[model samples]
Target: MATTGGARPYRPTLRAMSVVTFNVSGVEPVQGTFDDLGTPLHEVTFVVFDLETTGGSAREHAITEIGAVKVRGGERLGELATLVDPGTPIPPFITVLTGITDAMVTAAPKIASVLPTFLEFIRGAVLVAHNAPFDVGFLKAACAELGYPPPANPVVDTADLARRMLTRDETPDCKLATLARVFRTPNQPCHRALADARATVDVLHALLERAGAFGVHTLEELTAFARAPSPQQQRKRHLAEAVPRAPGVYVFEDARGEPLYVGKSANLRNRVRSYFTAAETRPRIREMIGIAERVRPIVCATALEAEVRELRLIAAAKPRYNRRSRFPERVVWLKLTDEPFPRLAIVREVKDDGCAYLGPFGGTRAADDARTAIHEAVPLRRCSERIGVRTRRPACALAGLGRCGAPCEGRETPEAYARHVTAARRAMTEDAGIVYAAVKARMDRLAAEQRYEEAAVDRDRLAVFVRVAARMQRLAALTRIPQLVAAAPGADGGWDVHVIRHGRLAAAGVMPRGAHPVPYVEALVATAETVVPGPGPTPAASAEETECILRWLETPGVRLAQVDGSWSLPVNGAGRLLARIELAYQGRDERPAREGRPLR
Candidate 1:
């Protein structure tokens, strides 16, 4: 053997020891299997392992010994013990503490050779260690050094489980020695790998016995029991047990069957189960789960369908925990009233009073931004007071500042004011060229004079208007169609079909894989839910629903299968305005350095 810097070089031993397997008290080790939630905890195999290393840090040290015991149903199935020849010398302090001297591992196999056999022993079993991260971290580091990928094994830390299962009065601490004494294990940890591993097995069994009182009978439930179990969560674990492991929507309902919350997930079982774990940190979620008496799962063929269904359920049930789309009718709209002056106004209820409506805005702020942009460009009356054609009312300060046409003061005739209203309505509904041109001219002049900050502000305002205008134009074109059918290839090998009636999603269903969609489409349309327009002027579709439909229709691969009415953007639509806005804001951050330079 050669020596370097007071450390012995790793040597391959002729007495190469492969992994040792033995049964404890004649009980054979059962092979481990996948973690199925349905599997009973007693049937699952656990490989409780531990490591003795040259130093505390896995990254800076090397393993000197490895020990593990495989157990199932409170019976020991197998055991493994091996000493590893660490490439570096074991520190004197570590040797004294663990009683593992340098000579003990002199001719032992190197970690690279021992790791493969150790991994094979623990394969198919849930890895358990006193403080798992330490042993697992060293194993991972060794694998990395050997250029092999680490094993994807589920790990359980007895220290963490002990903390949750044992009371302070019972153990006083989660240390392996403390737990060994409290549980009165046959094997006491002596700072050696095999001894510590044996002690961990006993600790694991003790914790499992304690966990049974909490109704934890499965491996999934046992792992979750590591977290501090709330009384409410422990009582409601059965609610998630019946949820299917499929993409779907899950509704949490109260005792009266009223929905408390609605959520979508790719895996209903896992997502619903997460509510009982410590991972769920939302305070509102904790409160909701506390009161939830039942969970209902509606399986969907695809995630997209799940999302759409979640939105619909949220809107219909108005779940107390859901904050979005609960009141779709509350969305604000910028309306051009049918009065003589036709001032821009924010209204929630859409009516058929022959007025030009611009949105289904998500909030008042966006609609207010559009209103300000349009008012600034076109001099429509800014006053809110009703002024008839015959009535004469004094003008406000806006008239003197030339911000309004002063229709109340009769400074502008009815016909003249009508023309201004027409231009504003055209900008809102038909074409935004006039407004865009005015804002662009002002932005250009400001930038030319080196008013960069003001220019940026105007540019942002113009962008808001352009985006809203484009959205309104697209929505209006869709609403004009009496009936429309659009289909897109779903991720799950089917076509997701949507039927739109009066701009609302009347019906939606999936065309099965490898099946003709014609009959399905016809049946879906005929049996579609009827959304009647209210006696007032509101659209049959809510803004949230319309936006959802529009987003789907605009997806890249979506195709319009059939159109019962015209569906086309106007030739002079606000689409071009969007392009102009994009051009104006491009490279805006670099504008400060390029001030006084002409915009391309």
Candidate 2:
């Protein structure tokens, strides 16, 4: 069985028809099976459906009109059209586009009156429409609201059909009007139900001839062929539909349901959907799409919040697909402790307390260029000995290159040299005052010397530093010292925490951050330590609360630790990551460490 357009071939209610054979008496029921017709349909079966919509998007928009025509064996059926009152004011744009005005629908039968008959007529037919999915989605939504199950029919877009059918043609256009013109079918008034329905029929006739030449007369074969994108693309498409329009970070998971990719964006919905869009055919996206099983997202307030969240998820999940870069020359940092020949190092890894990292830049080359710019602006030692904390004599190798001024050889005092280092650190991390001060000072000096070019360069650097540094410190409050707290801000301006150990609850409590943790800690930690006589009530949590727990429990270790001022927990098992992290983070400070160890 083959269906055209978007309709599926399903059981149908056969239309009653009368035949006369010169009978004067009442006619008897016709007795025959499908074979009695004596001929089988060889051409594609098209279930052409039409709709007048209140607007575009299926999610927010409603359908105002429906019309359909079933065609097979080059014969089109009589029109089956219905008018629907969308239950809301139809905009003027809709009225202009569809020519379905309010007064006309005021007396017309509503969708409910015609739905049963319409569905019965369309069953066992492949749905067809000029732009089929739009109509089908509305039909499905209407059916659901009417307490009727969806038709479960796959849609075939006639617009897509035309595109494929004439891919090589250099015609005027591919719009319905152009399609009609190409086939020399008379132009029908736009937006009228029966007229557009008839035009669609003409378009399908022209398309089928081209499609049949490629052995694609049946809808089933073409549908199967079109659905062959990697499983990743499919899952990504599914996730794109689910994400809300918000700013956030999205995590893409692998087939076994593990996080494989983590990314952030100011517009979470748009950014995540980009990976699933048709143009994402690059090798990296293809691979990510192949492995991705889920797209989970967390909303944030700003682009910087999104960036911080993205970095946190990447570090915590250690997604197998995103391997961190290993090149040392590409990493940029602020040498906060550098003094007496202070230097700005371009290195891959962050060394403890030696320097503060500011970027994993757009690319390795940008980072290298930034380092070059810094070195040009401020002379410093660039030798292995000084960087490694070894004694160095005379000037380092970079002295002859004008990058080092031999400050380590007592050409400049350590205190005087420390000012430059402070300036650089401020430019990278704090970003607020130092860059402006340096630029203004240098600009004033250049202007006094009448060197406008040099002054302009300093001003531009000042602007660049301001922008980049602003991004780095966007979530300053988020990356603060971790004070053990019982809960995060809840939707209702309250907090929640549950105390459980060995898969059972000993006590559950909630306390404000300003309140002392001693009593709550005592109760929660005791739950983890005390052996209960019998199994306690299982933890009762809403979906959102359960989700919060599951996310926290998934970190790498069982015990909790703070990473760069953010609260973190460790996990041993990959499969139990979500559950484990949840348990660890819930009442984290309250649970005293095992064997009399300190909670901190």
Candidate 3:
């Protein structure tokens, strides 16, 4: 389907193959799970075909001729060429181009009879064509109309294959006639079906030889070998061959073994191999694949452990390819200012000065949102200036509006303001019932008055406040414990046991059904890594790691095996309040949808 173009004939030389990384870094994850390249190229049967249609559109056109050649290992097994009698008269322009006059095809076989034969010939063999979509589209459209199932054979485009190796410096463009001339095939195209297909066969063989230098010798590799991946990506694909099909982390590195990217997946082999496939469309990932010289896989006992390891590795390496979670220390915390008249402050550091902290928020906006919500519930001062017992300043508009106690003006006593501080502190660390109640009352009053927008505004503030408070309290409880052992039911009734030290995953294993948990738990704890506790809420590990541990422990059906200290929240805690706020939000969100209004 290619027209002749003025260009110089040339052949391209591929870069020489280099050393590849085929061995995995850590222990084998799971036996017999690694993917192997299927079916070598020379062993595959390819049906190279071409078609001459009456028009450009597959829906509007009819096939005038079908020509194909079946080949294996550079030997032609058979050739199929037939004039298809389109029921409709052939267009004048098409007749002039293909030289197939109306009288010549007046008694030829109809497409309905020819389709069954064509489908049978291409069955179980890879189909090859130039600009394949045009030819394959017509064949598939005919099959759909004639009650015949579409052929399932894989397709390869010599046009695309030529583009992979030939650049503009060597060839002006990728066209069937151009390639046929460049490769100097025995058969030449003259707008005839059989001749063009035969010309494409030689072009394919030359392209395959070029592809062989890139390590694309298998049918699977050829399909994924679209643009002929960079020499590194094509060669480094073997690094994923030895990985296990289990939950773990994978690190891509440069030739010097410097980390380029760190990621985790429930199945390590499948995820790592995706990098070398056409399915990975991210431009940055493709670039990383091009630079990657090796892949280091670390298999974990559980998915949660894999996730925790990914975060830790990303934070440690600060890989340029990863866009998030590289600098956990940059997170902000909402600290209750330790003073005579305390106020909520969004600070970036966590100190051991005995001040109540509420977060490790990823951004200042989230910390500020939660702070504003808490201020809506409690009459805490919002001034940036520090205030002590002896300090004095004029009352602001908030104090005049009765929103604050005006401790700066000495209009409110420290003793009297201490009560409000106590309530705010309790909301931050232990319970949020008072904060949730105060906000809910205001929201309900606003809703009853038909001020839904105002009510939603209050709801937004309360949402962030309750969620942060609940999350921080959960993290604090677990991080305070010196050691904890827990188990969750795994597949086939096995138990995924974990030893957590100060909210960090120290050791983990899978305990078979009917196995003694106490002995297994004891052994795991004994072998667990040592963690020297730090100060503040997160003592041994990061706040993110503590949150991960909390989520694993809170999963349904998970049972506690052992604990070194008490790990409990207040009876009236933020967990219940967080659930109520979530339910209220769900209803508010659904109301707009049911009423046909746009939802936020």
Candidate 4:
């Protein structure tokens, strides 16, 4: 006869002739305690389960029965056993294997009716099974068919635990029946769900005892033990012990106390702990960890602040493992020489020379592209030889090619070359329309002739020029402001304020939570150092510093508190050229096509 009970009550069972009491419940279990290594194995609640199905494939099979035993701190809490009607015919071969005949399940409840009760019984417990993927796969499939998300409980497979815990001599195979004999469980294999589940409970305890010898006392440690640590990682495990569980940046330093790497994370302790695991695949990171003697963390109030601090720290420390933004001072700039001819030149350092400057580009390549765009539009001198007012110099080949005005050979008078220089400077600094119009006209001509590849090249060149020009113009505008104060609402009801003097960050701090920002703002400005504008060609701010400030200013809810100088873009500025360039690149030209045939 089939039993109609929902769930079996916990029963007192004898272990080694001593009777042990057990508690049974269907409600969610209370959460266990967690320490640094995570919840101890003894305190963790586990649901040891096994499923009998029609076939091996989850997608093609249907569950015939389910058996589970919930245990906490070595005490059996409850048991669940049910025969589910698959809603399909039970094959003759399946009956021969499990002895569950079609007649036996005809009166059983359908899987849809039994799954809910099983899920409720196992809530707030770690799932355990011998060959867990088989059982978990079927349960997850049923959940999906019912339009419910699969249970997210962490699973432990005894088959995997056996491989990690026991030697081949102790257990010749990882099969449940083989492990059952080796562990000497009270129940024997009977090809039934409840019998196998009761047997698995004993196997779990045996493996836990073996795991304890390797210092795997906690659930997290046991889960991670398969990827065993190396001698080096084990020795350095103490480095991550003191890191706090908070959003922040971590600096890995060597014996000399020099930073080897810098990284940011929302949880400092967990992120740092991952480095000592087998999951860390980067060779350079492993090398850094091997050499690291200490790990330092700087906690931040918010993720945004952590990112900002990471950038600042990387720029300041130039850590060996850090690859980007290491040398902000090495960023190149495009300078128009302070001379009569005033040719465009790529320079590493910004000077206070009377020439117009275009960039703090990350590399010379971007500056070269911008220079090419300007030269194609305005016929400025292309020669590198220094030319004086009366110094006689022969014309370079560019002069004959009509690519240069050739101020070197006096072929173009100083006055005439100065006009070209002025046009180039205007395209570089105040307005990019002059150069953008030329590039766009060429791109449109190419597209009209169906020479799309050449058109793309011109389009890319214009993109580089316009982007750099817009950035340079914005930085220049900000630098013109003698003093500026901006503030944004920070995390935890505080205000993050920045003081800028001539485009450089003069002072930055946060107003305490629940405090009025007006007084803090006044005090910040009063104590800020006065940064006088220099007469050199270099702007007051480095490109990295200016970019950082720009990012902060463009934040979604940022507000301008005060501005002693104008913070406005020119009416004919390069900012206007961006839209036109984008439109041309999209194959839409607002201007009429030229009459001439497209150049090859």
Give TM per candidate: 0.58, 0.38, 0.60, 0.57
TM-score of 4: 0.57
Which one is best on TM-score?
3
Off by over 4 Å in 1: 1-235, 245-247, 277-279, 300-305, 448-453, 490-494, 513-516, 533-538, 579-600
Clash pairs of candidate 1?
A: 350-537, 351-537
Please provide, for model 4 over 1-600, each residue's C-alpha lDDT reduced to its tens digit, 9 standing for 90 to 100. 001111222212213332233446656544432344477676788999999888888876789999999987667889999998876667888889888988888999998899899999889999999988899999999999787789999899888777656766798878888988887776766778988888888777777766656777677877777556544677798999999998889999999999999989979999999998877745467667879999999997555456667877898999999888788878787888986567788998767667788777878988888888888799887666678677667787888888886667667788888888888878887778888778778777788898776776777777788888887778777888888898888767887788888777777777889887778899999988678777432356565666667787888988999999688876777888777666544522322233222222
True-structure lDDT of candidate 1:
0.78
- Please report the TM-score between candidate 3 and the true structure: 0.60
Name model 2 segments beyond 4 Å from true. 1-45, 57-59, 152-154, 168-175, 187-189, 219-222, 225-476, 479-560, 563-600
Q: Tens-digit lDDT track for model 2 on 367-418?
A: 5544544544555455545532344467766766655656656566666666
- Residue-level lDDT for 64 in candidate 1: 97
Using lDDT as the yardstick, the better of models 2 and 4 is 4
Off by more than 4 A, model 4: 1-237, 244-249, 264-282, 299-309, 391-394, 447-452, 529-538, 579-600
Alpha-carbon deviation at 545 in model 4, angstroms: 2.3
Question: What's the C-alpha lDDT at position 218 in model 4?
Answer: 74
